[model samples]
Target: MHHTIEVEDLYFTYPDGREALRGVNLTVPPGVKMTLVGPNGAGKSTLMLHLNGILRGEGRVRVAGMEMNEENLPRIRAAVGMVFQNPDDQLFSLTVFDDVAFGPLHMGLPEADVLLRVETALRAVGMSEYRNRVSHHLSMGEKKRIAIATVLSMHPEILVLDEPSAGLDPRARRMLINLLKGLDMTMLISSHDMPLVAELAEQTAIMDNGQVVACGPTAQLLADHALLERHGLAP
Candidate 1:
């Protein structure tokens, strides 16, 4: 009965006077797979940042029952894995193994445990063979998988991904989808891919202009063409 992710009256404004989130209130119970659909500049990415306290705002944000603040930022980040929109941002190590081991090592795990986590995570994403590959030389799909392995190594209770399927070829996208379906943690995905949403999310939330406009069962919302159109999610 516990909520894995919670935001109450959350508001975020950039230093340059750009408001991204407006009183966003939502909760995802443990182990639920949810999709966030929104057009450009809808604050979906901003909201994801709030989950791990990357971009703090005005209101209560909690992950796995821990309040997100400076004192608990480290633990909160360890518990909530975020796969950013751009794989380049996540993979920066000279080799894929270093990138995947970065989080666990930073958390100060034993060297043996860190290596184990890196191997297990890479294997989970089916990228174990690329352990020694340089990230800068990897293809887009390989980088994406390596990015995911970096977070998976942390063993986060909740997984937040932004545009996970973006810029991938059909085969790569399908492989990513299959990898997601096999995961067993709470997932919050922000994507405009309706087909992926329909296949992966049990619940869907529609966002626009920094607020959640409508949320409910995925099938019901997908069936409502008018609602999708109203939110600029459909043609």
Candidate 2:
């Protein structure tokens, strides 16, 4: 079985002495969409950081069969795309075109190819019309979409996202959902929105206290009212 992402007995601790992850074991198969549901301090973000070598942790971590180490970090980052919780954190360029094209441009691709990638990614996220608009002038929802496009332009195999629908209005939310539906790649999403999770993920993992308590089919996990209540996923 080939896994796009793999981890074995992973452990991570913050400099402030907070143990963010405790022996996390996870595997994301190629082309699978898995949502991670957990409380604020459950270490979901920490785990995601480990995927592309943003934060090196103890034990084994692998992406697309390559171990997560200094030597493999660059290739791992190219294979994995991460969209942060805040669009502002990810989008710093003056224009949408620049932000979306940043990754490909930095990779030494020809200018024509970089432009093509930027256009394709913008179209994929339904942001092609705003390609020349200033990033700071866009609405929250628009910024989010562009942030996604910026990463998508890299043509990564694994897409990791955190709170993708944080500030989207109803219409924008629907658009984002539809956009996600059209994507045919392995996705690791972390969000508090249960409805979105139901629509996007085929599988789900429940994490708490720095560990994954359970993982299985999305419907089965979400249907467990008692389990959800215990973990604060339900009220």
Candidate 3:
């Protein structure tokens, strides 16, 4: 019964002396899709950054049975794939194929293996036809899918997404939701989209003022309108 992720009394502060995370504690079991919901500045992104050692704070953070530290960073990062809110931030290569192949290539995988990973990842995201296309020229939705494929090519066991559905149109959002539902890895998604959260996550954790304030079943938490309103999730 090993947990996929664990955080204990995590605390972090920015260089400017602003505290981003305040003694946060969280745990995600393997194969669970959990949504992290909170008002702006609640430290959701900050917390997600710690999952793979992007932001090392004062606390214990573990992923895939490895502790968060400089020595374990490479392994931890390989195990935890992070997809940022903006697809542009994740996509930098010339073509979609290059962008998706970047991680596997960096891992020093063989040429054939990298090619296979790129193809498999693109097919998973329904972007196989866009492999040769320019990454910057695609639509937001297409770019988002490619961004996800970039991480998928790494063969991560856990997926951490930050505001994945932001700026998506109805159709794009729906498509993203479907794509996420199809991914079998453990996921911790940070988003304000309640409906998307409801559709994808079985468990939900609400963050506020740099800490997790509530956590429970998605249906149970979403049903508490007063709690949602208090956290700025509902009007």
Best candidate, lDDT: 3
RMSD of each: 1.1, 1.0, 0.9
Clashing pairs for predicted structure model 1, backbone only? none
Candidate 3's displacement at residue 195, Å, is 0.6
Q: In model 2, state the lDDT of residue 146.
A: 95
Q: What is the lDDT of residue 141 in candidate 3?
A: 91
- Candidate 1 matches the true fold with a TM-score of 0.97
Q: Quick one: ranking by lDDT, best first? A: 3, 1, 2
If the candidates were sorted by their TM-score against the true structure, best first, what order would they fall in?
A: 3, 2, 1
- Candidate 1 minimal-lDDT segment of 10 residues: 226-235
Writing each residue's lDDT as its tens digit, candidate 3 over 1-235 gives 6799999999999999999999999999899999999999999999998898778899999999898988999899999989999999999999999999899999999999999999999999999999999999999999999999999999999999999999999999999999999988899999999899999999999999999899989999999999999998972
Residue 25, model 3: lDDT of 91
* Candidate 1 regions with alpha-carbon error over 4 angstroms: none
Poorest stretch of ten by lDDT in candidate 3: 226-235
